[model samples]
Target: MFKLTTAAAEQVMRAAKEGGTEGMSLRLAATQKEDGAIDYRMGFDAATEEDIRFQSEGVDIVMSPEDVPLLDETVMDFVEIEPGKPHFIFLNPKDPTYQPPADA
Candidate 1:
């Protein structure tokens, strides 16, 4: 299953409220690039019958069946990579360039 960090969930919830997408599930999509990198896209959306639905950190999430394998066991996080910019990032072991976070 996929995981969503608390920070990520907070950001998503905030965005949904601000964007008027409340009550909708967050849709996540993953595609493998030719070079073996995994690309991720996400937004608030209405889940279809065939979509895989789950909840993490009180956030409703949806993903297509075909995207499950690539996203399985992935952890999504929102962090400050630079001084003032924080954004979402996917920690997917299936991605070739992915590196596990070191123990704190």
Candidate 2:
């Protein structure tokens, strides 16, 4: 199962509220690139009948069945990589370039 850090959940909630999608689930999708990198996309969206639904940190999330293998074991986090530049990041072990955090 995919996980969302607390910071990421908070940020997603904020974005959803600001975008007037208070009741919509956050849809997450991922595709593996030819170079063995993962491409991630996420946003507020309504869940379809075929979507898999789950809850993490009080946030609703939906994804297609096809995305499960690619996203499984992935972690999403919100971090400030530089001053005043916070963004969501995907930490996926399946990615060739992915490195485990020093603290891990």
Q: Give the clash count for each candidate.
A: 0, 0
Which pairs, if any, clash in model 1? Answer: none
**Candidate 2 regions with alpha-carbon error over 4 angstroms:** none
> Model 2 residue 2 lDDT?
94
C-alpha RMSD by candidate, in order: 0.6, 1.0
What tens digits encode model 1's per-residue C-alpha lDDT throughout 1-103?
Answer: 9999999999999999999999999999999999999999998899999999999999999999999999999999999989999999999999999999999
Give a tens-digit lDDT track for model 2, residues 1-104: 99999999999999988989999999999998999898999988999999999998999999999999999999999999899999999899998979888884
lDDT of each: 0.97, 0.94
State the local distance difference test value for candidate 2: 0.94
In candidate 2, the residue pairs with backbone N, CA or C atoms under 3 Å apart (3 or more residues apart, or in different chains) clash, namely none
TM-score of 1: 0.97
